[model samples]
Target chain A: MSWLHIFFALILLPAVAVGMIRILKGPTAADRMMTAQLFGTCGVAILLLLGAGMANPVLIDIALVFALLSALSTLTFVRRTWQPGKKKHDDPLS
Target chain B: MTILYHSGTFFIGIGLLFFLSGTVGLIRFPDIYTRLHALTKADNIGLGFVVCGLSLQSGNWAVIVKLLLIWLLVLIASSASCHLIASSGMEKKIKPWTRP
Candidate 1:
């Protein structure tokens, strides 16, 4: 059973790694913010898999904390960086 | 018992496949909104499967509830964060990607 779980972990970690590529060179800060969500969700899976594979139940609780707090960074990023659109019209007289 | 474990493995495999597709979409999609759409949808579904798969091995109600809770929280976070990012992008006037 543990071996089967270990197999799952091996595949799941790479999924997180693939998401990281976007974080490294994504076009904007918002794009990078998506990475935070990816990490949170993926982290939960990996932690659970690790917990199951190792027979360590604590990891699942840790994963629960990870899931609960996943949105914090994205909210902070959007508040800090994203500005409201300004309305401006080009005027010929200026 | 063996059949149950095998079924669980099958679900996990499918979840991983979706995770792969989501990452691919993230890379290939034209812009942030599209990437957000692809990832939030794909990853949530993937997590759903993974959680179900894990729950198969959970002999106790507490473990099942804990697994479900984690997936539920992730689902909410994914949708809410997607909204926050997309709205913020719109606020900042990050133009939506359009195909020529």
Candidate 2:
């Protein structure tokens, strides 16, 4: 059963990896941040599977933290980082 | 008991499929608005399925509750953040993609 749990966890890795490509190719800051959002949810799923696989409930606590922090991060990104009336061209690299 | 385990595994598999589709949409969608749609909706559902699958396999009541709570949190957070991102993008005058 642990192996089954671990196998499911392993499968989610590619989803996160593929999302990274979007970060690289993203034309806007929000695009890159969206990848970060993807990471948050994927990370939560991975952590949950690992918790079940290892029989460590502590990881569930960590998964909870992951969920909260991801929300806060995105909230900050929108309110502070992605300011209103700011031109999209304000990004230096793009 | 074995039936429960197999069903849990099936749910997890379905969850993984949702996750895969969400990732594909995030990567392939033409605009931020469309991508936000993909990320928020699909990913939250995927997380909910995973939580359900895990809770089904878990014997502990506390863990099951926690898992459900986490799902609720992610659902609320993702949707709120999605709205924020879309509105922010609009404020910056970012246009939606049109079919060519």
Candidate 3:
């Protein structure tokens, strides 16, 4: 059982690294947002696996909340990015 | 005697292969859209398999239910988020790659 937990953790770590790369190197804001969502999902999975491995029930609730928040954040970002708007230039002299 | 252990190991191996392929796809894909496609599809399936293997080991009905719920939530969230991101990227006119 412990070995399975370790195996899962090992599998998840590479995903985390790949997600970080996308977040860092993504060509567009939307791309970065997608990468962030990936990280959020992976994070929740890791927490759930850890909880199950350690027999800690409370972590499941925490993971659930994290999943909900991640979904909400992605939705908000998508809405903002998709809305029609003129590009805002931040120039004090304008 | 050893058949059950072998079966569990086979399931775990398949799950690990999925995860590895997903990571490789993420690293090697040319564009954000393609990468998202790979990650959303492969990771969710990989995690699903892993959860199934873990639940088999657990042998607890309550914990199995919880695992299933978590897997469902993950799949839903990942697919929805990926769709939203890809559409938003298209709306923003992010240049898609073209092989010459």
What is candidate 3's TM-score against the reference?
0.80
DockQ for each numbered candidate: 0.40, 0.51, 0.29
DockQ, Cα level, model 3: 0.29
Which prediction has more favorable TM-score, 1 or 2?
2
| Cα error of candidate 1 at position B62, Å | 0.7
The residue-by-residue lDDT of candidate 2 on B3-88, one tens digit each, is: 87788889999999999999999999999999999999889989988998888889789999999999999988898888888878
The order by descending lDDT is 2, 1, 3
lDDT of 3 at A72: 82
Candidate 2, superposed: residue stretches over 4 Å from native: A84-94
Worst 10 contiguous positions by lDDT, candidate 3 chain A: A85-94
Estimate the TM-score for candidate 1: 0.89
Candidate 3: regions farther than 4 A off: A1-3, A81-94, B1-10
Sort candidate 2 into its docking category. Answer: medium
Q: Top model by lDDT, which number? A: 2
Return the interface RMSD of the candidates, in order shown, one decimal each. 5.5, 3.9, 5.4
Q: Candidate 3 lDDT, tens digit per residue, B1-100?
A: 2564456456655766777677677767898888888788887887777677766766679877987887888888888888766766676687777897
Candidate 1: global Cα-lDDT? Answer: 0.80
**Residue lDDT tens for model 1, A2-87:** 98788887887777787888888877977777877778877888888888889899999999888877776666565555543332
Docking class of 1: acceptable
